[model samples]
Target chain A: MQGTQQPTPQPTAYPATDRTVPTRSADRASYDKEIVHAILDEACVCHLGFVRDGAPVVLPTLFGRVGERLYVHGSTGSRPLRMTGQADPGLPVCLTVTHVDALILARSGFHHSMNYRSVVVHGTAYDVTDPQEKFLALDALVDQVVAGRSKDSRPANKKELAATAVIRLDLDAVSAKIRTGGVNDEPEDLDLPHWAGVVPLRKGYETPVADPLLAPGTELPDYLRAL
Target chain B: MQGTQQPTPQPTAYPATDRTVPTRSADRASYDKEIVHAILDEACVCHLGFVRDGAPVVLPTLFGRVGERLYVHGSTGSRPLRMTGQADPGLPVCLTVTHVDALILARSGFHHSMNYRSVVVHGTAYDVTDPQEKFLALDALVDQVVAGRSKDSRPANKKELAATAVIRLDLDAVSAKIRTGGVNDEPEDLDLPHWAGVVPLRKGYETPVADPLLAPGTELPDYLRAL
Candidate 1:
């Protein structure tokens, strides 16, 4: 079986383009789809950037991922959403998500760094037009917040769906950059009396505060309980 | 004494420009200097955006705030840093920092949201040339990662400083948007049997992992211990 096995034909990484490649610290950049997807899924929000009137604008917003596509939703009246819908082809955008895992404190200030995982996606965002696809995107967005949440929450009604606008960006040009492990202090600075180490940052959910208007018989959902 | 009293002349908020205002959720946007500063100080990393080749590009990087100025440092050869240095005018940029406080899960998918504080600055970033300003910026960058860290670590030497490039963006044309409190569900869906509420997210630091080659007698600094 080992000698006769066929070479794998599938591509497991996103094709690296000129835009996705970093000019410095190229060793930290990765095109691995698994690494990219994990970083994207773990992040709660994505900083979306787009050009308006020849100037760059960046905003933080919630996003959901379905396979190789990302869905970002906002009010139909939102400027970015309106532009995505009105543009001839689509709106060029860059979406980035970062998770800081730890703070690397070194003996030298120049060596201070962060242990982080970040994914950047450069693509054209098209407004979601199809009703069925929009519904799926909405469900994915709800589930992205909490696993199994889409089923638990009431689906958006026709009026509600009409009020929301969703833009879809395919994950074509994507790259993940990651830095991990401990402090890297130079030999000369190792004995400088500085306490060098890795201070890990952790994200945790505290007890959920039930809404005052919640139904009397409703119980905390298992999905949230797990968190 | 009452008749002689003079109104305070100092401005407590930033001047909001057209670009700083959100097209939607205008009510969430703030021009208060204190609000913007607090949000910026709490965040460790910021998503910086610039137009490259006529398309928007967003990358997450470490940043520090000193009064009204924000500084971001990286390798001198990095793409954005180089562009800021070479551009005739300063490079136009949009810097955004966001902190998610809680997840709002509602009875309906449409009502789901997040409680977050975010600041966005629209301005041109210029490369820092003055050696004194660069040194201060570098110190602020290190301190931004951990309070009092700049003093604890050795300052960058001449060669190290030469290898780093710092870009400065003034906190003009800045706005902060904040959302807080509980789920905002429609009255008709309040009794829909869903456990709607806010799940608070907390950021914490785990025990510090000392470097393998840390000085034998070095102790954890009080600044880190306080964390």
Candidate 2:
């Protein structure tokens, strides 16, 4: 009976908007949905920007993506969450996540740069009010930390759920800017007797430190072992 | 004659203002100058937020810090850099850097969190015009990527300087927030059959990849070897 509904067709790219397009280095920007999702999913934290008192405020927080929507959660008393609930038109925000891949050392100071992949999303975030959607978002947030984490852990109770506030931002206006490969030094400076190359930076996970209070019978989960 | 001048006394902590204070998790926020500086120095990129057309925009950019000011440089045609030059009273901005040290998996989904250190600076940014200060800031920016890098590379020429725009923001309004240690699972859920611990994340520099056009005699610098 459930098979009668048609699955929504997914678009390959996000349409470029005035805000998503870069004023400089336009060649580095990509509106491809795959690139945007890959960059977002690889990072654990995002810097969220919102306007307060006619000034911009940027805060770093954990975020999770489900399909085309990104969810950020915090305590009910948090400033941005409370503002999102009170604002009728939703709170306008810009969320960005960046991963610095390599340090680009050029022959000249002017060309020194960092190779990075970053995604910036400009949209209005609305408070998630529906209980079903709220629970789903919460699960996605947990699983974002480690795959299959939501099912392995005990779910939130009524009181804990009431204390949290979740905000959802649709990924409509988004772009991924990437700087890869080696440094681009001027042709004249190529012969300069200075070291020019890329110092690659990689993120690795060390051994997990288990809590002292962990139950004796509890074993390390398979999902974490895979990580 | 310069020795007779009094040395500027450094304060141990940054002065907290209304905006730097968080509504929730007040205990996790700190105003110590040393803590703020350590977090900033360890980060390679910062998310710079500014208001444009009455909406918030956050962009990831490379930055450098001197004694009391932070410098961010970009092409003269970049959006924020151009706006800083044109704004009379300077552009109000928020710059934030974050380091995710570990991932905390709790026995319950409600307690999942990340161990992170983040610094948030809110101030007005002005364009740097003086040639001497501009050069100093540019040197600092290069050294921020690699210690002693500016001395190794060719200095920027007049034409290069003309095409670059540098913005200065004072480190006046700032706060650092940190979360460390193990997860805090509910007492009732402590016996749950789930693994709870912290997965430590470390950043490492791999073997330097040299450019094919590098001069034959050029060698990897000692500073990079130290990394």
Candidate 3:
């Protein structure tokens, strides 16, 4: 009966903030909420940028999206995780997820670019302390990896939950920058003898590798079968 | 004739620094130079983290790798690019590249994790100003996307070269952390009904899409065709 509460409403678009706009290619920036969510949901990893002692440190970590917020979990001993739960007022973080769809090989090296969809989210991340919300966020994190996974897996026990730290950052200032389709070669460089095109990149799942100690006759679940 | 001089001798391994070690999962980290180079070379995009006004900012950008240096190019007017060239020494930056290999679904929520290979590099980036070195860096950038692309494409004109800025980060303090194989479920959770396995992720390149404005009779180059 838990985690069956009301769902968060989706916004069609987000308002552009000073940090969200692209300084290089302004035309490629997007403020569409759906676009931002889709990019965040599809990527399995996100680069979390946080300032430590006035220096920038970016760490790659697993992340999950639920409603309008992201849930990133780590061991209680992790630096950022420790900072989030114990630090007052939370820690400012910028999380970004990117999917490189293609290599845009242009006629000139100076024009080479990438066809990618990326989401950048800026906000202060607060520790999820409420048991109810933390439980739901944990569920969302599992389901984010494999849809319907939380229901199948054993829920976190009290001791296990206490050992983990989950941080929540709302999607208030978010932006999606996307570059789709063919190259943008200079007009004068179009007739160059070189090949100019997009080599599209696609991600697919291979056959599953089950644990060596799985009980005999344990069938692969439909959830993973689809992946 | 300038950048064609000496090929950097490949380092057998990188020395571990305090910053490169992982606190929570120390076993997964490695100072192997080969592992770091492989991860960086395979990924098409990198998240470049740098401080702007004392706040951390991470940007997804296309990158190229030379023997022991990484090349990231941007417009001459871009903030980070301008900062590297104008700053007293260079801009302190952390560049990270990651490849998500699989989703590890375990019997318990706390045990769920990802199989990934990621490289984190901490260094100061300086602008490549010498015309010879700059030209070669641009070539490396293009070659990183598609092998042999630099020779096939037209060389950059003086004006185009002037408009681009390339920064070099030597691979001095680099580390690669990789996690592979099946789920690490607890001994007690083995008999749970949930499926425990790894769904491997694979990246493949689709047929190259030709530019719509290509002049008639331009054939697909063998370089892209091979991909």
In model 1, which runs have C-alpha deviations exceeding 4 angstroms? Answer: A1-9, B1-8
Per-residue CA lDDT of model 2 for A108-186, tens digit only, reads 9999999999999999999998888889999989988887899999888899899999999999999999999998999
Q: Could you give the interface RMSD of each candidate, to one decimal?
A: 0.8, 0.9, 1.5
Per DockQ, what order, best first? 2, 1, 3
Q: Where does candidate 2 stray beyond 4 Å?
A: A1-8, B1-8
Q: Docking category for candidate 3?
A: medium
Classified by CAPRI criteria, candidate 1 counts as: high
lDDT of each: 0.92, 0.92, 0.85
Candidates in order, TM-scores: namely 0.95, 0.96, 0.92
Q: Highest TM-score among the candidates is held by which one?
A: 2
The candidate that achieves the highest DockQ relative to the unseen native structure: 2
Residues A1-227, model 3: lDDT tens digits? 46878778766888877787878788989998777888888876799988777667789987889878898888888978888865478888889899888888788777778888998888888999999988998898888888888998999999999998899999988888888877888898888777788888877788988888787788998877887
Q: Rank the candidates by TM-score, best first.
A: 2, 1, 3
RMSD of model 1 against the true structure = 3.2
Q: Tens-digit lDDT track for model 2 on B1-227?
A: 46988888888888878888888788899999989989998876899999999999999999999988999999999999989774477999999989999999999999999999999999999999999989999998998888799999999999999999999999999999999889999899989889999999977788899999999988888998998
For each candidate, C-alpha RMSD in Å?
Answer: 3.2, 2.1, 4.2
Second chain TM-score, each model: 0.94, 0.95, 0.92
